[model samples]
Target: MDQLAAMATFVRAVDAGSLSAAARAIPSSLTSVSRQISALELHFGTRLLLRTTRQLALTEDGRIFYERARSVLGEMKEIEEALAGNRREPSGRLRVSAPALMGRLLIAPLLGDFLRTFPSLSVDLLLVDRNVDLIEEDVHLALRVGRVADSQLVMRKLGEVQMIHCASPDYLARRGEPQTPSDLAQHDCLVFSDAPGVATWRFGRDAGSGQRVRISGRLWVNSLDALATAADSGTGIVRVPSWQVERQLAEGRLRRLLREHEPAPAPLHALYQPSRLGSAKIRAFVDFLVERWRGSDPLGR
Candidate 1:
């Protein structure tokens, strides 16, 4: 059996969702599609799919093989492109994963311009609040906020965003503004959480001088929008990414506070699975991001 052809056929089946669908896409017969899948299963010595008339599901081994197959196929294509001297222009479907809030706020706005600049390229942006496996999710690149440490993937520094403390005019009016990070203990704070509650807030110019102030709050919420809105409604003061409240700060809905003690700016990064043969699209996008974010800090820390 021709291994590459078989792999291509198996990939098509997974992409198209069924044998018939795959056959239609390949303009080959359903029998041929079945034969390729059978060849793959036999070669791998494992069941690739559990298929019935109505549905198709990949087995555990099948799922693993599929992800590897995709990366292998992509690398092969990139190699071919490089040999053909078509590598200068990025021309393919580039899949990206990013945080929901940052993607929607900072990255999404840049998509149209990037596409326009590279007419041959297409993009798919997947935005979620959690970490995603690039290979498992078929993501070509991930634009992330915060410090990421991963040995398996390649990382590139982009820029940083300030994490600032802010409060509404009414909240400050009622409870009085904090004179120092130490003073936060006397006031209601809008806590951000992944768990049940927050017990402290950290502040400093650097790691050596940093301090965490023990604090209490009436509201403990998980959502960024909700946290900002809570602060805006005079519910409580919050520590949030400065970029998140650009409009609120400008319009005086939320006033910046404790600037002298705000923590060091969080770094932004572009991450991707390592490849011997790199993706032009990934390089182009990363370069675009670096170009856009240079000498800018959420529009101050």
Candidate 2:
């Protein structure tokens, strides 16, 4: 089988939604398109697509193969363009990793527009809560939330997310609002982290490296949404990233607190392996993110 040609036909057929559509797009006979796809399935010893008279759907194996093949083809096109000295429009596959909740809430929504801006570019986004090794995960780029201590990879600063101090009006009504970080010591505080210990909330200070006060609460939740819900129900004061609780603050489900003592916002960064240093697609995406956050106030500042 002509492997590359077969893969190309398979991809086109999938994209065009039918063998006849693929045939028209490839400017080839329907028989030839059909033959190529069959060759691919035979070569792989697996059925790539389940076809009905009206539509096509990929099998589990087929979807995986499609993504890999698309990435491979995209890279080949980029290599050909570079060899021919074509104008660089930032083409090819970009594998990006980001934290799960943050990625969905922030990064994923911007991707449709990003892809529209650079049509030749394809993204493979991996959303996982844990930090991914760029080289191990085969990621070309990553959007990381919070403080980054990974000095090994190339990093770009992409602004920050504010830590919003908030509580319910009823909570304050029952237990008076804390005026300062130190005052939080006397009130119930809902800790967002997973461990049981003295929880620390920081406050920005004019003359020093800010203030840290230890507080204890009746409830602590690992999930951000759950933490917000607990705070909304007047459980206790919760400090969370502004992005997660912004809706509650806006709708008055949760009321902001300690504006004067708000801690310095946690930073966001784009990280990539050293091998990806010269990649145009990675550069374009990072620049796009930096611009997207510039003076846009995602932190609800």
The residue-by-residue lDDT of candidate 2 on 1-301, one tens digit each, is 8898889998999999999999899889999988988888898899999998777999999999898787666556545644544356888778899877678887898899999999999999898867886644557788787667877788887777788789999999999988878888788888866787777777894326888788786788777778788899998988888888878888888899998888777777888765556667877889887788676667554
Model 1, residue 270: C-alpha shift (Å) = 0.8
* lDDT of every predicted structure (CA atoms): 0.83, 0.81
Per-residue CA lDDT of candidate 1, range 1-301, in tens? 9889889888888998898998999889999989989998999899999998855799999988888898788777766654655436888888999887789888899899999999989999998888888877778888777778777878887777788989999999999999888888788888877676557777896867799888777788877889999999999889888889989999999999998888887777788877623667787888887777665544244
Candidate 1 — which pairs collide? Answer: none
Task: Give per-residue lDDT, candidate 1, residue 92.
Answer: 81
Q: Worst ten-residue run, lDDT, model 1?
A: 292-301
TM-score (C-alpha, index-matched) for candidate 2: 0.66
- Clashes (backbone N, CA, C under 3 Å), per candidate, total 0, 0
